[model samples]
Target chain A: MTGSLIILQPGHSVVTDLGRTKGPAYGLPVNGALDQFSAKAANILAGNADNDPLLELTALDFRMRATTDLLIAVTGAPLDLTVGGRESPQWEPVSVRAGEVVAVRGIRTGLRAYIAVHGSFTVPSLLGSCAPDTVVGFGLKLVEGFRLETRTTTAPITQPHFGLPLFRLGITKPAFTTNPVIDVTDGPDVAEFGDTAGLLFTTQYAVSPRSNHIGLRLGGALPERQLTSEVLSRGVPVGAIEVPSRDELLVLHRGRGVTAGYPVLAVVTSRSLDLLAQARPGHTVTFRRTTVAEATATHRTACLELERLRQTINTVFGLLGIGAGQRWYELSPASGA
Target chain B: MAATTTTTSQTTLDIYESGDAALRVVARSGDAETNWATVHSLAGWLAATGVEGIHGAVPTYDSVLVEFDPYLTSARQVRAFVLLGMRQLDFVGTTLREPRRFEVPVVYGGDYGPDLDRVAEHQGLDVEDVIARHTAKTYVIRCLGAPAGSPMMDGPDFPVPVPRLKDPRLSVPAGAVSVAGRQAVIAPAVAPGGWCVIGQTPLTVLDAAREPLVPYVPGDELRFYRIPAEDFGNFAGQFLEARP
Candidate 1:
């Protein structure tokens, strides 16, 4: 069956304008979705894959016109949502009447938000990812008058009966505190710094406003460098904290510079990357080393738990005899026995 | 005073865990050539031996980073495998494949290359002489997958290695041929950069729409062909078509 389409008009949102470009002087920081896991979860709620295209709004204005009833979920950073001028909760699936305009306003808490609609968000796909790689201008950035096509599912619109807070399921909740403790493992070049440097990492460091997805310019007592000579350029992965000089500690992220001459002191594990992504300027961050075994174990467990959650959602939908698009707000379980 | 000589022997391979997902193998000595050769040899051997659970292996100038599925393989096991591979590396030759030669056309001087004269002055040579020297030398590609497939080529063999610009521009136009230290690169797309621009290439090193998105691979030899600004559009179109 041909799915319905919704035309989304982008408003004054920061997600529309931030990304990487070659020019100016320093490399552009890829700042888009801060909580990728939460964004993925929001997509899954809309019956789409984890990697599907979603609107990433960063404390800005975003508007959408419902061509038809849409099964949409808004996750990540609490933002005020108004449909026909009424307050709506940020996390749960909401039903909108045809042609009603839905608007998202400045984030009251948190730094980023994700809005996912069922079916493909008709935007050009580059590099097999609908997600924008701001480091390279490859995805659709929401701009005024830009129309995004989203297929409206015919499945009965279902609102979440479960009132559980989204954060309980490993998603970040809107909180006032900015200081976050991020876990890390020693980088390949960590040995370049003496034993004192390792000790210094455990101490708290302030996150500078200058931080972005490319890398974080850490504010703290600069770690000492034993080897001051230039390091041969090498491939860098996300969460790599490299110290180029004695004063600056550059914590590399997903959209980091392709190569760097600095010596990397530590790398944040995959499980904790989301936390680092949400870190705000002036946030206090501290690192604690974990054994290779511990880090691997944590990642494995997290993956398994996520898979289990998906299965649970499928079972719940099946038991209700109501397919994904069915909107039933009733909390009663499917009848049996 | 008596003349004395000291010789130090160390392990050819040193293994360290790069977080939980990967481990790094670094050569003890700080020699660039030796380190690169060793890393390439090690990577080649690992591919040939069919190490289980290894996602992919990338060799840099001084180290080889091996990423493995954390679920399937432990970092300890990967490190052990690398150590074992180092022991058997003698059976495998340390030589890399011969580099493929390609002529890259460049529009030097004027706006395309604002720093050409500065680079020339730094080398105590005329701008034309600088172009001649740059084009004369064959450069080896160390890595090719930077922003928009920037080819990191080895050298101009200058007496003094040039430093990056103290104040980098926010937007450096694509196809910009730049040099920093002993390395030269062709910017595949417009991005912020600090490298001194010596010229601009007509070739698009990376094009997403094209198959084999990145044109140059590691072990490719590059020579620059100086072209006038008027021919840039033609050369760019031809370069795009040449890629399959």
Candidate 2:
């Protein structure tokens, strides 16, 4: 069936997916939903695959109207959710009639939110993904009056339902708060920090306003280092906490460059990366070091719990009518392990 | 999370957990060889091994950033495997493979290359002579960095180092071939650059939609040939753009 969503007042939104994991080798960054866990939850609740195209609203004032009857689910940072001027619950499936207006107001807490429908967005794809990557020039970057057309069938309209406890930092939360604690592990260049590595944990850093999807600039004390010769520019990963000579520390996010020049003192854990996604500008963040074993343990627990929750939500909201081509999303907890 | 375990005596391989989901295998010391071919070859060889959870290895000059899955492969396992792979690289020998070369036609000097005269002046040489020195031989693509698909390659032999721009240009057009130090780079997009612009190539080196996408990968070769500025309009690479 053909249906469309008209943005009444677009406030920084883009059509995104789980992003392309395979394209990074071609000098592409892994461009996807910053808060992947919540995006997947939104997709599952909307009766779509976890990697289905999502209208990721980064700004707070996102308003749209349905041109046709639509089954949708909103997740991530809880905002002033409304459907046709009535308050709607976050983290659950809901129905909107034709001409019904749905709006999400100034993000109450988190940095972004996900609006997933029970179908795929009829946008262009690049390098085998539909995610919008400004760095790589893929898909559409939505603006005001933009229309998100979709190819989806009629999904069962259910009464307002609630999802499981929130997923964050390897723990389920009844509600999310601002400036959550983040866990990190040693980076490839962690040894270079030497004694200065302690500064990564002892000092608290605030997310600077300059922060965007590309990186989170943190204002903090410089991590001390022995003045060694220049190290060659190397590949940097998502969540790598890179420190330049005199500038602020930067945490490479989902939209990070494929490689960089500075040394990375620490790397935020995968589970904590989702938490980092929710961190708004001005949010104070502190790092807690975790061993590879500990990080792996929590990452596994988080993935298993998320998979179980996805199945539960799919059963609750009913599966999407996707075919063999788009039947299942590859949800490898550890990069296709 | 632990101390590095070297697998070979010739060089130490430092394999450690990079982030939560990846392990990086680095050659701790510089190889006797030049231009980082050994490290890049090691990365390619490891990628060819088909080890579990090893997603991709992004090689810089001297290190391979190996991304692994913590679920299917532990850091210890990936590290050990990568160490073994390094040892295998030693046994098989990372021969300097022949690089694919493309003759990039450029319009040197004048408005197309704003800093050509300055670069020639800095080196105390005539502009035509500088151009002759640059186009003398093929340059090897070392790494694509600084900007996306911006190929950094070995520069032509010169008596002195080429001076960088005192101030960076706000908008450097794509295909602006420039040089500094012992290396050269072809600007792929409009970005602020401080490199001394020797010429402007009409050929597109970096396009996301091209069949091969980028014109040069690591270990490829690029050659510069002087072309009349009007001849720049003859090539299709000048008009190629990413359709997204």
- Compare the candidates by DockQ and give the number of the best one: 2
lDDT of 2 by residue, A1-337 (tens): 7888898887888888987665556666777898888887788766678788888888568899888878787888878888877777777666777788998997867888999987768877776678766644557867777888978644335343542222222224325567678899887777777898888888888988988988889898878656566566687888898886466888889787676767778888878888888888888988998988898888787667767766666444432333222223433355656
Model 1: per-residue Cα lDDT over A203-289, one tens digit each: 778877887667777777767778667788765656678776556678877576545667777888866776776666777878877
Which candidate number maximizes lDDT?
2
Q: Which residue runs of candidate 2 sit more than 4 Å off their true CA positions? A: A159-175, A318-337, B9-11, B28-35, B45-52, B87-98, B121-126, B159-170, B192-194, B236-244
**What does fnat come to for each candidate?**
0.37, 0.47
TM-score of each: 0.81, 0.86
Q: Scoring only the second chain, what is candidate 1's TM-score?
A: 0.85
Question: What does DockQ give for each predicted structure?
Answer: 0.31, 0.49
Candidate 1 backbone overlaps, count: 27
Candidate 1 chain A least-lDDT 10 residues? A17-26
Query: What DockQ does candidate 2 score?
Result: 0.49
